[model samples]
Target: MAVLTLVLLLAGLVLGALTAGAAPDKQAIVGSALGLEGKLGAAIAKAPAGAGAGQIDSSAPRGFLGIPGAPQVNPILAFLWAVWVGWIFSTVGAFGGIMAGVGHMTIFGLGDYAKSFKKTAPELNKVLTDCIRMANQWLVGLSSAISSLNYLRSKRLAWPLGLALGAGSLFGAVVIPIMTGGKISFSQYQGWFGVAVFVVGGFLLYETTPKGQAGKKAAKAAAQAFEKSVKEGGESAQGIAVKKWGLTRIEFSFFGVEFGFNPFWAFIGGVLIAAISSFLGVGGGFLYVPYLTSIVGLPMFVVAGTSALAVLLSMVTSIASYLNFAGAAVDWALIGVELVGIFIGSMVGPRTQKYIPDIWLKRLFVVLALYVGLGYFSKGFFGQSWVPM
Candidate 1:
């Protein structure tokens, strides 16, 4: 099953790389649709009607035969560029897509593609965002799948929580992002996204403080339970087993620890998580995993699996909605490459996670959350990155 999953992800990577880069410039597509094909018209006039082929096509092949074309990037380069994306996803269970987006807008900027949009700043920003969302969805979705499988096999997944969260996330990931008549510009998207990240970061930081030592204690206890269970039943027995599940309540046992949670509350939280993640082009791990561990009081191990499942579901919903409604174009070449790395890393991260203590995960979360949250807040509100351009 593991090998098969890896194979499937690799196949998808190749296919996405082959076609995603073939997407036409966003401005050209919209312009042609709106009957603003003056350039194409002029070019057509300049060509002789004999053997010379002067044409204008939106869905033309851009990256066939190892040639990188407009919007279509080289798969090899994309793969190299996306290593960090996969590594990050595997580690924390989210934000891989958002990180990719940030990369695309800066050092690894899509200069050639954005330059084509000479219409206006908003138009160019729109294309940039569309690329980010498209890449984010595909890259993170595959990453979540790999991680979720590993977690599920370990028996740590909170099925009831995952389902409840998925239910609300379906709408939040789909309906909310495309509600407006037109696309949201980068500034507007970033502003709202920044606020969301900032709040989540603040909460997580609080959890790391002395007052939030309850979470720390809980982590220590869970780790001890994991160790005890492993000794008693072997590694196979050191996982979560559902005791009960219902509309309002959820019950499960991890190793030797019993855990109960409010499904309805998880559903509510899922809605919020999905909304922010979908709009901001993230998998909601940075937020979801922390929420489960710190607020929902689930163990760090359990949170990883539960959040991974929820993130996959939400990404699926977000991808479908954006493509179907917003007509958002995907940077398949970039995402496909990222997916490959993500799949491999995700598979490894979960399997090797048994050795790590819970405190380390939470500490990692707190630091990353504070940094990313503040950075995003600055970018969104001030129209600049936390450090600089």
Candidate 2:
């Protein structure tokens, strides 16, 4: 029954994608017939064909902003990209959604296409932006679910802390879509996204320095123990045990190293992070990573799993709000194929992460955050990207 259901779902995704591609303008016509104005339908009617002034093509491709020959995405590239996204997020417990955004906006040319409609059809541009945000959450949402379960199996996840954070995130996640959805332009979104990633990258980079490392004795000790367990091939040395749980504090031990955090502060952090993430259309793993390591003082070994749990909770609410209240739409074919890849990559990340050093995991995050942040920020605000896609 499970296999049959899965097969049916896949079939539906394929059919949906095919239908959208075959008759791209059908949805627009229906919207017009139903008296639903503004957004994509209006964009199609208003957008210029680029051939001459006032030229319009009602049958424009979805992401091309009425340019008939704008490049179609290569499904293979998208699938491969999604695989990478899943792995990174599952392994590091952050940045999966940001990377997914990069692929959707930059690699697939959707960003340029969406931005093109900003002046001609501001409503349409915002709608496309919302879709991009919605799509990013979808990939992250699935990756987070898989990563959480895998980490739980290994006893690396901090369930109590995650639950507290998730509780706070629920409120923020639901509120952001209602406030910002259908209002933000693609370029504005990109600029802010870049700024956020860049700022987090800087903070994390500082954490890697000797001065920053001075205070993180617990994290280093926990990391060493985890690495030793990996080398010795013993389950005895690997697992997280709850030491105490209270309204004010939550404590856990990993490989005999104790870590604790204030549950109240964690909940507050969750609310703020979820608001930022939902607005930016990300999983908030990047933010959670820093919070766990610096504020919560957990070692990298446990941070990934814990971050995944919070992300899963926040993403669920954010995606639901976008689809239900914001009127966002997604390309089922693209999302469907990418989801398959995300699952494969997510499954492999936890198993492979045990082999990598804790410090290296953080270093990886820094590199990606810096690079992605700089490129997107410059492109969005300056009208030209400093880095090549």
Candidate 3:
């Protein structure tokens, strides 16, 4: 499985570079196809007997049709593009999930450690908080330095770093459960915390953001273009609302089957999940996948495809956010290594899905949800720390 994943990834990278270079000029072709022309016209009123001289002045129409270039995208190439994109996104989602898991463990574990000390030495609570805060800052700085170093290296150091971090995180996760007497550290709780954090953080960032200021300057430009479309088209209330909210519908036919959805909504959902996950230390996919499947009423297969697309968008947003706000704390090497593993895992997932019964899958989801809910309830009500119970 690992070997297959690596091969696919290499192929995707090669294909991506080739496609980027070979993409045809859309502007020239579209312009030619439309046969658009620019002209000026004037109205003339004839006086009695003959319009000996009708005044003529420069006059311009309020509008003109302009066709932009359209890329000559071959169907086969497009399908390949979709596959490669899907693979890339799935890999990133996997990375996000692992990072969220590890990060949450670190936070929760430290919190518990603080409680244990504070319980016995009440005066040390303030000191513990200060120490944790300092440690967090130091960790951020260290991660940033490592990331810079990794970027400079010829060969990626992601694998080794990932192994170390993953091992340490897993150990912490395991120990937390055992230390808590197995009563509080349920998998469900961890998943929920991760999902909640990703969702909430994403929402806050986007909602509170001043209009047209949440993303890169290019994204703002796209928003402006969309707004212009609304104005020019004289769209209806619903159309205007959708345009204002950045809704976009996309359709594709695959293997004789038609699939379609609003990519914008899916992207927003992913971003919301990613932000919340960052805060809570869990993967955003827990919420994203469920929402895509259950709420969006998509089949499991299509849900996976759509979620992968959304995850890619979310990761882009996340990377942007981290670079702007938390770059110092992120471990790029670790992310890269985990991505390799995730890529492998994601490829395997599709095959597994083919064999798993729908009933079983649904039941599994329900069980996971129940477990997480119970864990949170216990933690909030009993004030139980997340140690191994």
Candidate 4:
């Protein structure tokens, strides 16, 4: 797996470099962008005319999409951040997209850059937000694919449930871009993104408490058994087995512990998750993790893989819709570097996860989510920091 990851990363780097070519010269890029004024005008017809007059400064250094004075991301930092993004998602089966969003919007300074255009060039700000959202999905999409393949090979993935969720998510993913793409501004996007994560973080924190774990007896038993098997070096032989499959309920077992979920409700849950995820430009794994644990009573070992499968399917529709229908563009050069890192990080996660306790995994991300959520939410919504961040 490590060798395969390295090979994929190298190949991706070469392909992305060849396809993206060198960065365009500022004058040429500015000229080309202005040449499309007629089309750009029509695209932003929803915005008032002359709103962004004199906003274009050809003398400024080019950034993403040839925007003047926009912050240029360092490739090394982007790669490192993506590696972290892949690791978290693959390890815990959640927060990969939110972390990716944080990198694009905050770590790279793109969020502030886009927010600068909210009033002068509301259309531009919205477009940049869409691009950020789409870029986030790209990282999640690749990580989820790799993670899903790894989990599936180990027999930890729930194919029926993942596929059902994927199918249901297709509807929401497709509809969201058409309805809200090119419509959300950076501030609004950031504010809402923070809110979603913050709320989930609080819920997950409660889940780690004794009271919350009270109802999860089966999950706890399975987790303990899986942990014991891992320590004994015999877990690879133990995998999920389907006990019963019916129209109403799907039953499965791991380590002799049983779990079941309603297929119909799972589909509905998928729809709602995808709608919110697509709008937020995330993989929806954060939500999926809670659902798998709280509602379905699955152990972490199974939840990660199942979440990865669902994310893989949902990201495909979400990315295509944003690009084709929403007119969003991504920096392939940057994404290429990030993809290589993501592949490497994803390969490491599954191998190392067995050593950590299930509760610890959830706890680690919950802390991060709450901190980031509070910072972004308060700043984005109120123009002031509620936390010291």
lDDT of 4 by residue, 1-389 (tens): 99999999999999999879976543211333532233233333333233143255645666665555568898899989988877876786666777888999889988887887687567778887888988887777555556566775666787778777777788778888888888888888889989988876877787788877785776788989988887545455567788999989988877888888888888887888888989987777667778888787778888888877776677788888887877787788998988887778888889888999778988988999899999889888987658865
Q: Report the C-alpha lDDT of model 3 over 52-141, residue by residue, as the tens digit.
A: 111111122211111111112233432333333233234322223323333323323433433332333232222232222222222222
lDDT of 2 at 257: 84
- Give the alpha-carbon lDDT of every model: 0.61, 0.76, 0.36, 0.76
Point out the higher-scoring one by TM-score: 2 or 3.
2
TM-score of each prediction: 0.60, 0.67, 0.31, 0.69
Residue 365 in model 3: lDDT: 37
- Output the number of the TM-score-best candidate: 4
Model 1, stretches more than 4 Å misplaced? 1-77, 87-98, 111-128, 154-157, 180-182, 192-247, 250-258, 299-305, 340-380, 383-387
Could you give me the TM-score of model 1 versus the true structure?
0.60
Residue pairs with backbone atoms closer than 3 Å in model 4 (clashes): none
Candidate 3 stretches greater than 4 Å from native: 1-108, 113-252, 255-268, 293-305, 327-382, 385-389
In what order do the candidates fall by TM-score, top score first? 4, 2, 1, 3
In the range 11-82, model 2's lDDT, one tens digit per residue, is 999998998779544222212312223344544444444432223343445333223434477889888998
lDDT (tens digit, per residue) of candidate 1 on 1-389: 99999999999999999788787554322232222222222222232222111222434444321112334555665665576556555665444555565555443545323423323333434544555555655666655555566776655677778888878787688776677312665556555655755565566566667877787788889989988888543355566678987777788888778888888888889999888777767666667876888798988877877887888788877877776666555545566566676566556666656777545765776666566666656765675667544
Greater lDDT among 3 and 4 belongs to: 4
Best candidate according to lDDT = 4
